[model samples]
Target: MKLLFFVPLLVVALVASTFAQQASWRPVDTKILSPWAAEIDPANPHPEYPRPQMTREDWVNLNGLWNYALAPKGAGMPEAYAGEILVPFAIESALSGVGKTVGKDQELWYFREIEIDRSLRREKLLLHFGAVDWEAEVFVNGQSVGTHQGGYDPFYFDISEALQSGKTQSLAIRVWDPTDEGPQPRGKQVNEPRGIWYTPVTGIWQTVWLEAVPEHHIRSLKNTPDFDNKQIRVQADVAGATAGQRLRIRLLADGTPVGEQLVANQEEAVFMLDAPQVWSPENPFLYDLEVALMDGKKVVDQVNGYTALRKISTARDANGIQRMLLNNEFVFQYGPLDQGWWPDGLYTAPTEEALLFDIEKTLDMGFNMIRKHVKVEPARWYYHCDRMGVLVWQDMPSGDMGNRWESRPGVIGKGTEKDRTPESEAIFRKEWKAIMDANYNFPSIVVWVPFNEAWGQFDTEEIVEWTVDYDPSRLVNGASGGNYTLKGQIMDMHNYPDPVMPDPQIWGDQQVIVLGEYGGLGLPVDGHTWQEKDNWGYQSFKNETELQERYSRLIQDLKPLIPKGLSAAIYTQTTDVEVEVNGLMTYDREVIKFDPAFLRNKHQELYTIKIPMK
Candidate 1:
């Protein structure tokens, strides 16, 4: 948490001109642009710290103008630089200044020069990437460092060995993304943008940076809260832990120390709290954590983070109907099917403020939960949710959409599974576990959604069983809006234009009943639509009045199901994506189709009702 040393004056003067040169570069003009695009400074695009949970003050942001080239897939490295592209923006995005698609046969290349301050590069220099599209191979000064796959998870390479013995170092990255051509976990991305699918995001689309750490520093932390025990269980993975080094953890409430623990070379540590405040939507309490690796009196490494104490489970109501219980209370969860997409940024939001807007707006609509449909947002999004008390249903981005799904009223059927190759299954398994582990510390996520509408559902019983066993902290919705396995904690149903719930007679005693998706009321704002014509929604509306009336009626119809056994419900979406105009807000986030106050008032009925828990 504290800077080890001060920056040299010579280094500051040297990098000032480099930042100016970087800022002078500009993005190419496009047909449409978001409001944040105009305020972007190439020198500091997404300059905020990428990882909030793991904070280190001394780090270099590698987001700026970078040399780029597109070559054949197996071409290795390009002989010549093609042009300059923005570091964090996707190559296909207009904000990148090179709106060119890298097809299945092509590989995208990025080159940049990094000025390393000798003072900051102490014992180890680590390069961190928030995310890269499909696959990325890193090179430092033409020396191959490492290769990483999976587009949605964070990865880092120890570039200390590859750094040259000079003030400046050359960094190059080669990437290959197949979009929908391969069976990777790409969420709704395609070469051809259509009704539900959007443009392909190739190459780097997230913040890249470099950090300095000790030789034996903490690599990652997994915090699990035990409300019953009134203590927090922490697992700290150290990169180069030595024999005598110990992990010291200090828990803080509002910056004041509450408890402390010192574990001897062990991976796990427990901190007891005097009076722990339970985390919920109403309280949203968070405790600061200071973790360090110490050798007696000297501190080797330290990082600051925060966590919350909460629990999610299921219980039966007075009528013997199963319902979702958050922290032992039967509070109904209702939220929109949040497809985290931006018109200007596509898969990436223009800024942190832009990304936080969706969550803030969701809460303003009086909804406490959000189903992040088939997309994983940056770590900061979950951090915001933790701080703001918004419950999340995190969905594993769907891939390998080559299966037939069967679902009918009053019938629970096992859908035909896709016969995917072993390689495909392995890829899915690896990425899903990585995603879960990466976000396990966040207390806001209440449910883990593995499959959505059976897009690539396979080995349903095994996958669900494994997922439930992997992290028993949160409830598992095996396949939201997909064929029900009736194995996990929730039996979900999908119905459009009206709210619907699973039959309580069949699944009420076993699993919680929920409306996975419903009420896609569409009203395309003329100027804010993705396309001029043929914009689509599940149910189309001509004006705001009609849309608002239909939405109110849907909620009105949904009230009766609460007595029957509806646990939760998800509306169509948070915002309009591409040509799909069913969002509460438009694609450009310019207008809210309904009055926020009126919608908030309508949503209150679902949350305020108290169903007796048996």
Candidate 2:
């Protein structure tokens, strides 16, 4: 959130030619070489259900195309639309059909018209945006309906009152994203992108749609799977309902009823399952769920959902060293440092297939986990992780205050820790809690990381404890690879181009040893980079063969550390991010740097599961 100051002399010249050329961008037909390049269907793009965990078959998909306009700094709503930008892609992204940066001072607007069915008109109409970066003010039928400020979480507005009873309705949105110029949790976005920091996303970057629900509908459902108790707690947050309203929750395994429970109002109800199938990397079993809101006897609202059975905790191993236990067993966690960047969509994936491709590739490479570095992904991303058997270390998007060059170092690391102001601390806490509340239901997310490499880090001990209390079921990485007070589950370290383990003496009993981040082996591919020059990685390679060889050597070196009590290691990244050309895959997902089978075999060799009895 701390604004970076740039001297006037440092400002690059505005190249009108580049802007003009990119503004007319559209999703290219992938019938040629790169078949994986996301294709835009004129009739149905990203028509699949957005929220896989909580799905309803009756909802409409509003994802093909929409009217878009970019107004000047502080300009009011425009009278004429500039052009058609694809819905759900950020205005700055190539897939949006309008690849133009929305600066801190500018406003990005979107307008779309939709018709409601007479059957749906009987129910309340709710408009949902999977996510809109920074700040968004929404208008329904020319009247301001609501305003929401948060980039990562989904939000909705009830527009039943504003709806035209028997005609088509209009929805307009005006968004303002300061990116790194404001004190909000803008993940890795920067005005002048370099290294890990990449392109900024402004306006709607996720699915936007409408759902018709009864007046007293089930607003939100939070399901917590407790393997320790062998029970799944279901909590329904109902809207427009009274105290005595009854809701029935049914749990099913492979579509067969396993358990059922009836609860009233917003209370936590438990459904006990017999011999529950616990979720793990090898077998990620999820139980189907259905919730119905009842008004006396008539069913008023219903929502279909799912939950996984899993547990994460810390326990001392045979050597008296603390270790992270998944499903009650010590498993050495090895995963990529996922930056969650898309070549075409920036923060948003061009298509759902593209989103799943990253996860599938990660799994194919023989890693069972991924440290989702500094960003929270869409709910469906986590849902895929749950289904595909991958563990996730979720980092709370950081904000507040820090020096770009100091706190976030390039070649060297050195920074004076600045105390966070009371106001900044309050905002940080609010956003952190909101993020947890939104993502606590995910089973694949076994760890909650509060700070990364000391970026805007403050009150480490207290915040770590707060995270532990917030969700006792998961482990907390107090601080990953930075100024550490040694107060969390993992004593994390960051050593790029080389791997390093925390001192066993200092954190022998307090925390599990982990190489939080390492091995940024860079290989930039031509015509697939955000910028030609100024690209970097910890170690740069000329081609894929060299990259794979160096990566295999790094993994071989990591094998000795596991016996030394190193429980986990997160490699630099899963895919190339903007200027950081160090990933298993290229930025556009056009190349796989290493052979998946070979990489998997190398990773499996490090685990104790395959070690011979000598």
Candidate 3:
């Protein structure tokens, strides 16, 4: 009788388990994945620390699989979920294990379980999200905590009070992204993926995690290296400083003490160094830092960080024309027009190694700078550039691109600017400021590009003036390949198939002339393209030999512009994206069409010519 009773119960249990698996599981779609994607453990995705500038030893990564459902945009909450989708990967991406699209009228929902240690519960619990697309509303144990409304910047919430009883608690997130239908800064994302426009990234496209901190902690840090003075200015933003709390900062160079500073109540201090190592592409050096909040001598909170000492400015070259100077020297900046995207993960790379791959490959291609076009990458991407010694020209992603763009070379043309709605303008300004503040610590970024090719360009004069005044430490390219704005330092132009400059005879006297984009030579290899048909490039080639020969000729043609007051040049791209097959490598990153040695030898000859002052 006992055996018979247990047998039926076991059968029921087995059937239930099978049904659950069938409802909540799906295989990853057929797409090109990096080697790192194969190594991803769904139990713990993105295990590495997300914030390189401010890091704590005690934290938990909340990536991995979560219960997910797609519902109407106005839907409050679904009592039941549809399936499971991978966190940190967009719902529309193949790596999410659910290659489904959520349109403008729908909202994506996520549910997961979280646990907190009883001992650590005494301290304040904070939830941190590296990023979420468009807008996100977070909840803890059935209670709403907060809502964040930015697709690119990081935001957090204090969910300590919302935690229910027991070690385990419920966590939920709701996300909505309108892609191109909205007037927000959506970058290149579009509901209908086509040439140059990519599939929309919706919900948690970056690492999500938790941290336990004391009542008083270091909320943020700003480290600015004054190269001329041999000192580093430090500012700490304390979250909960009591009456007698203080802040201390210690600077180190490879474990050796270089300088230290302490301030009472006030959060500003300067550390004068003995011998500062100048950071550059050839010899990239970083100084280690330890920041602490203390009650007299008792340590309250501590964090680890690092910074680089370098300078980027604009000055007249040997000629009377304006030129960009790096570390007080005139070196022509050459790099690819990098559009940050992936086949499997969309906006998110499969892994940290995959994130570093492009920078490493760019360095291998003998390029010192990268014009990061129309999109902001994860913080780790810039961290790699800082450590690897590659400079960056970061662009504010374009949206509401209704402006009439005029690309008439040799003619100074100011394109008709877009008239953004009050709400849309507010959204752009808020997000742009947040993006700048979040990335100000990284030393690799030398230029901040406000507009690109007149896409969503507006209020050129005022916006350019505001950008220049906001961050005088870095050079501002107000409009790259866009209108001929009389603000900012560089006059940039974009030309296809061949190298071209911004008419040195016109804008050379006041601003630096540069070819912001050019040379999109394309050769699509079979089995490596995103689609079988309709794949295109700015200039198509029949074979590897033709592509290589044409590429070398373009570089040879580019060198003569340097003597004519051209300060820099950017090639079309680092990898193929979507239907655009104008990359040095394939979309899958599986093939490099040209020989590296041949390309490097050709690029080296461009730098050998000396620039003499007039």
Cα misplacement distance, residue 231 of candidate 3 (Å): 1.9
Better candidate by TM-score, 1 or 2: 1
Candidate 3 structure quality by residue, lDDT tens digits, 1-614: 00112233443355345435554443365455544555556777778899998899878899989999999998798899988888899999887988899978999999999788876577788999998998999999989999988898998998889987899999999998888999889899998888888889999999999989887888998888788788887788889788788888888898998888887645667887777888898888999889989898999999999887888887776667888888878878999999889888889888887888888888877888999998888898988999999989999988988888788654544779999999888998988998899999999999999999989999988888898898877888888888879798888888887887777766888888888888888888766688887899999998888898899789888888888888889999999998889988887676777666676787777677677644
The runs of at least 3 residues in candidate 3 whose Cα sits more than 4 Å from the true structure, single-residue gaps closed, are: 1-27
- Which 10 consecutive positions of candidate 3 have the poorest summed lDDT? 1-10
Candidate 2 vs candidate 3, TM-score winner: 3
TM-score order, best first, reads 1, 3, 2
**What are the TM-scores, per candidate, against the unseen true structure?**
0.95, 0.90, 0.94
TM-score of model 2 relative to the true fold? 0.90
Residue range 445-503, candidate 1, lDDT tens digits? 99999999898888888999999999999999998878679778988888877876767
Query: lDDT of each model, Cα atoms only?
Result: 0.86, 0.78, 0.84
Supply candidate 2's per-residue lDDT for 52: 77
lDDT of 2 by residue, 467-496 (tens): 988888788888787666556677777887
